[model samples]
Target: YCEKFCVFVVSMDRSFLPETPVPSSLSRRIGGGHWDKPYNRGSLMLRAEISTVGDSQEVSSIHSGQSRLTTVGDRLMDSKCKCGAKEQLILCKSRLEHLVGDDRKRRRCAVNRGKLAAAGQAALRILSDDLLAAVTEAEAEMKACAARIIQEELVAGQLRESEIGIVERGCALGALRDKVASLRAIEKASQEKLRRHVDRREAERGSVLEQLHSRLAVCNELRATLTAIKSRLSLMRHRVRSRQDSLEVARSDMEVYRKVLDEVPAIMVDLANGERETLQRREELERRAMALSEEMKEIDTQIASVTNSRAQEVGGRKRCLEREGKELDQLAQRLDAMQEYVGDCQQRRMSGSSRL
Candidate 1:
């Protein structure tokens, strides 16, 4: 820590002012020299106005004729100077206290010397009392300075904690923002998928409706064709009934023919037997006729021989024999007529059987 001490002077006119100027060399000599050394008025007032600022390693801000102090305190040093100005001291801690104390002691000694030259032992007693009072005041000021430093340190620590909390809150806010963005993206994708599903369902519904319409048309056409087939079936049933009636009439005629066919075999057997008998009878008659013709020829030869030998001798006998020959011719003619009649009967029998 660094400390600052300032000392100011009040003139007899009761206003802050610079003290009577002193040479830099004389001020330095007075500050470093022993108290027993003789001093001048400018040096005494200059020492009373002197102040210092001190750090750990170096000290500065000591002016010979001016001060860096912007404010003057009501606290005065227990000393008076030949220039008729009073001294005001504002003390700090550590080395600043020492510097101010030494300057005060010197000012007091100079004041004491002048008063001692006039008032003797009584003036020395008053100076001693003022020095003790100044020391007590210095100690109280040091305690106040220590308390102020501690308060400043506490304020600085609170500020650092607040800054750290702010940084952590900022990081948490950033993470929350990123999580919200991802959720929004997922919601958008879900909505898009739902839209696509709706479109596909619409397409399928349209195709199903078209198929239903086509199937309905085909059903109507089949209904019309079924009506036409039913009408044709009714007409075919009528034609079949008429044809069935014709078939019944033909069945009756076939039964009668079947009975006649059963009798025809026996009738054919009888006709074959009759034709065999006729053929045998006709063959017998032809053999008999052939014999008769041969006999007639022989008789003709005999009659011819007789007529040639007895032609004049038997004329009447020839007349009788010619009459017998004419009668034989008549019998042969009658046999020819009977043979034709038998042939005609045979022809009539064959025609009758053929007709059957």
Candidate 2:
């Protein structure tokens, strides 16, 4: 009686207990097998419910110790009890395959014939109630599981969205960084170009300034040269004025000389006439002198012959002839004096002509 009581109490407790989650091993086995298929979930739920019902009925039967209470519940439990885990799984599969078809046929036949005994009707109603309760529990479990899955999916979706946003922001930051770097490089290049241009312009400006300074110095030199030229030109102008004065004096002297020269031509003609007359007289005198020289030469030759002849005959007459010879020498001297007077006259005439 104690054993029966204990079994009855355990069965009652099991029936009244809140449904627990499936064991990890049993669920893993089911999940690892064909139960992994989504379409088998309903069958799995039905099998679980049927197994619970069978276990409860088996416990109750052990308490009652009666075979007469044996029904579908005992049959299911007996089939399960006779097998190991794999066989039990196969039996559960076969029962699940026939459950829907058999229930439908039995309900249809009972309704059509109206031949069901009260006990059978009552058992059917009880089974129907149990099936409905199991279905409701399974539906509730499915709804809770679906809600949990949806919540998990929502959390996973949020995490994925955050990750995607982070990735997109990182990509944007990288692009922005690259753009900034490019902009900096461009700025640097532009700055360098500007600096070079400025330096070039500065060099050009400096060169221009230097050129301007050199040109200014050149201009100063030119100004100094111009001043010196002006001074030299003034000096030259003064010298030209003096030269003009000298040229005017020379012109006046030349005019006086021209008048004197015009008057001197008549004087020159008169002198020429006098010179011609003097030349005739001098020629006549030269002829006379030449005749006298010939006569003196003949006299000298005759005296020489007389002296030779008288040398023997006239010694006393020779003294008298010497006195006569002295007289003749005095006459020759007189003729030479006359010749010198003519030569002096000719020289005076030449001097007078030259003066003219």
Candidate 3:
């Protein structure tokens, strides 16, 4: 009977004891229990009764225990553990363990994901910075290339303008050179013509001088002949006067004889014949003087013609000389113009070369 009573006590103690603590590794399996039970066993409840005596010590102990239990129940409610059976507890400690493990794993995963996202963002930021730097460098290079091209183009344009100017100046110089050449040719021809004219004029002047000298000699000879003729004329006149005086004396003698010879007629006729012969000789001398005067007039006309011809020749030579001088002046001016043009061309060429 005692053993049986002890067994009953042990059984009751076992029912009141807390459930065994589940291992952390095995908590998930226990929380997910699939054990089968009958419908009536799930609904069954076991009850225990205790006897109380009035004024008993055990009763006081029991009342004190009951009060303590009630106080513990109130405290459990406040702590949010209102369920009475530890084995059938609403707040599953085994499930809580499993949930803590699950939460730790989730938190670790979230942390890893956040770290990965941060690393990716950092990598993207670095790539973007590098790209921006490369783009800026390329833009700067492009700008530099454009600036260099513009400078080259401006220089080329200036060179082209200089070349064009040089070409135009060259053309002008060429034209001037041609003009100078033509003028030189003209001047040369004019000089040759002038020389020929001078030569001819000099020859003509020499011929005129010779003719004048010859005419002068002829005039001197004529003058000498005229002087001799005048001397002979004077001598003839004196001889005629002496003969007249003799004739007068003879006539006076003859008159005395005629008175004596009034009886002789032959002597008187001979004296009359002699007087007629003397008169005829005087008339012939006057005729010779008139013929000499006509000859002198003809000589004067020939001298006047020679003088007029010499004057005309001299005037023609003077006009020719003036024309030649003018041609020489024109040639000099043309040469000067050509020289200036050449100088201009040289300056332009030098300027163009420097620019190039």
Candidate 4:
């Protein structure tokens, strides 16, 4: 019984027990129900033994008849009491009773409460931290997505602007090309017209050159004829001087004959015959002088007519030469204008080529 009781106490307080087993008498008392009544003397002694093993409430409730037993056991244990008594056993028993009261009903309740409280607090802290981190991460992701969307929109707008610029430049270049083609066509037409005008001018110049050559030849022939007429007129004036000198010599000789006839006169032979012969001689001499004067006047009139005709021919030739000169000047002006127009066209062509 004592060994059984010791084993039960050892099991209950294993954290405080030593390596040794309990006494055999205590083991037997623990196993038997004969120790069930607290007032029985054998049971009271058993309670005392149980109190030494820390079963305090059982010892306190035992019979008062066992007080001496308890006191003797206290002395044998040699322990001090709180009441200034040398009663180690009694003090140990009273301490065990106090510890085994209704307060010790559930032995592991307090420790379990502490562990559960700690676990709950740690779980609450972890959950709060995780929630805050999730909220922050979600906000950051939303901001990044918004920024990317804005960048894409900006790039799209720039692309649209570039496309518009390209289209406008293409349109402008096309218009310029059309204008250039029109100008080239107009220039080609003008060149054709200019060529025709030059050809016509050359034909007219050739005709005028031929006419001038013919007029020059006629003028030279007229000059030669006028020189021959002037030589003939000089010879005729020399012959008229010789004739005047011969007439004067004849008159002097006839006067001398008249003087000789006067000296032998006074005899009257035939008066009517002498007077008729003298009158016939005077009429004949007067007729010869009058014919010579009339011939000289006719010659002077012919010479004047020839001089007027020569002057008219010379004046006509001079007038024609002046007209020809004026025509040549006009032709020169036309040629100069054509040259200037050609130069302008060449310059325009060069400029157009540079632009291309």
Of candidates 3 and 2, the better by TM-score: 3
Give the distance in Å from residue 350's predicted Cα in candidate 4 to where it truly belongs: 92
Q: Which stretches of candidate 2 lie over 4 Å from their true place?
A: 1-146, 231-233, 236-356
Query: Higher-lDDT candidate among 2 and 3?
Result: 2
Off by over 4 Å in 3: 1-135, 236-356
Count of backbone clashes, every candidate in sequence: 0, 0, 0, 14
lDDT of 2 by residue, 1-356 (tens): 23333343343332344444433332322101211223232334444456456544544564476773374444444553533543443344455436545555644653442332333345445555655665575566557656755765675676577558656755765676676567567656755765685577567556655755665565566557557646777767766576667756655755654554564556456545655655665566557556655755665576566456545434444464566457546645654554465455445433432322
Cα lDDT of model 2 overall?
Answer: 0.51
The candidate with the higher lDDT, 1 or 2, is 2
If ranked by TM-score, best first, what sequence of candidates would result?
3, 4, 1, 2
lDDT of each: 0.45, 0.51, 0.48, 0.47
Q: How do the predictions measure up, each by TM-score?
A: 0.26, 0.26, 0.30, 0.30
For TM-score, the strongest prediction is 3
- The candidate 2 region of ten consecutive residues with least summed lDDT is 28-37
